[model samples]
Target: MNAQAKPSLLAKFGDRYAVDPNKMFETLKATAFKQRDGSAPSNEQMMALLVVADQYRLNPFTREIYAFPDKQNGIVPVVGVDGWSRIINGHPEFDGMEFRYSDALVTPPGASAPSHEWVECVMYRKDRGRPIVVREYLDEVYRAPFKEGMKGPWQTHTKRFLRHKAMIQCARLAFGFVGIFDEDEAGRIAEQSERDMGAAQVVREQAKALPACPEEQIEKYAAVVESGQRPAEQIISMLQTRYELTPGQRSALLEVATTQGDQA
Candidate 1:
């Protein structure tokens, strides 16, 4: 028998993560390529992911970079906060980055109520005469006029998400990753801005009214998933394709999946 060849990053990833690297990367590349130009993942595309994995130490199996559903069944690959940190901190050409958040208890005289919720990011490069600066505001992203009962990063995770938004935008300004973005941020903006910026209130109210899932459904979903006859993706794809689950239900199902997976 021929000696086994050394593992590429792809194969090594299989040992590092519980996920099947082949399937995980396959789905990711398919989604990444579809976002690129509406085409399937070519060998070149898969190689590109390998290069990226090395460059940023991202783990596809763990969703360091992931695919988010976009328009027309296409998908957008989003880099998580950890991935963003790796890219920025590992860049050889940069002196490093700096971020600052406003801490005033009250908003400026002309600014919106309560506080100035924003962050500023500065990317310092030795070759450049000056640092690249980017400042993003919660209001610029979440268009809802400042009022009570709004569901947004401003209320939910203001400082953290603010810094996140600013850092990602700053990364774009410092080194443009074409066709790549923190789509999770876009999703948050969409959620808070939908229906003339009123969806948040309705969503929260609806969430309060909805009862928990039937215990039998959770048990069954968990059992089938833990059995390993059908991979997690199979269950996820079937649910998304065959049934229309509300956001709350989807979240509940995901929680069950996580709990059961951990136990197994």
Candidate 2:
């Protein structure tokens, strides 16, 4: 067998970027080459870079930088650090990037929401002499409205808030992953814990009176409480579903629930 060769980034990308000569020639006939005229690169070029960068899982900002299209041949070729810094430092404005959609492409009816969504495909620009994916160009278009909010570290905070909310939701979901607990046992523990603190007998009496609710409803009630809603009805529903408890069981459950709260 032949010796193995070290893999370069391009080698890794391989056929993903390989262009078809016939298609490239056809694309060149459709659009004019204007890169050298100091005009900004087209949306098509910008989008190709965006799609490629996403495939590589690069930083979002770095991905955004790829949005700038080189004007030379309408092929937004990746310009190394020098081209990247020029845009970042405000030396030259990277303009002319825009997003567009084609209506001819169709999916099965009702498969998804009826909205104009971006589709990814490699496009050839005669000016650039290479095939760039068109999806990145579309991303640049959708991203234009939020350009102002993206400057500096604002995007970082946005990402952090999303991550924080996701973590909280995950934590809440984790409670259900463990085996369900018996409300009667939970109440007894609460009563004993309260009693250990030398609480009044009324508290123990209340704990014994509380109603038992289903675990799912308890989770919903917790959410309702967190949302600042009085979840009394939800609690009642839980009591009905979990324990098949009559009004008396609910009253008892409430009393015990209050005792448990006091212990907490």
- Go through the candidates in order and give each one's C-alpha lDDT: 0.63, 0.37
> 1-264 in candidate 1: lDDT tens per residue?
999888777677666665687885666666543444556655565665556665566766565775544433434456778878877777776788898777754333233345446779999877788999998876675434245554544555455666788888888888765555575564653444455346667766675765545556646765776665655556655665444445665666667667777988
Query: Where is the poorest 10-residue window by lDDT in model 2?
Result: 175-184
Candidate 1 local Cα displacement, residue 192, angstroms = 13
Error of 1 at 177 (Å): 2.3
- Shift of residue 207 alpha carbon in model 1, Å: 39
TM-score of every model versus the real structure: 0.49, 0.15
Per-residue accuracy of model 2 over 18-129 as CA lDDT, tens digit each: 6453443233223322233445345465345434543433332332223222222333323223332233233132222222444543222222222233433332333444
How many clashing residue pairs, candidate 1?
A: 0
Best prediction by lDDT: 1
Mark the regions of model 2 whose C-alpha exceeds 4 Å error after superposition. Answer: 1-3, 6-8, 11-14, 17-66, 69-264
Sequence-dependent TM-score of model 1: 0.49
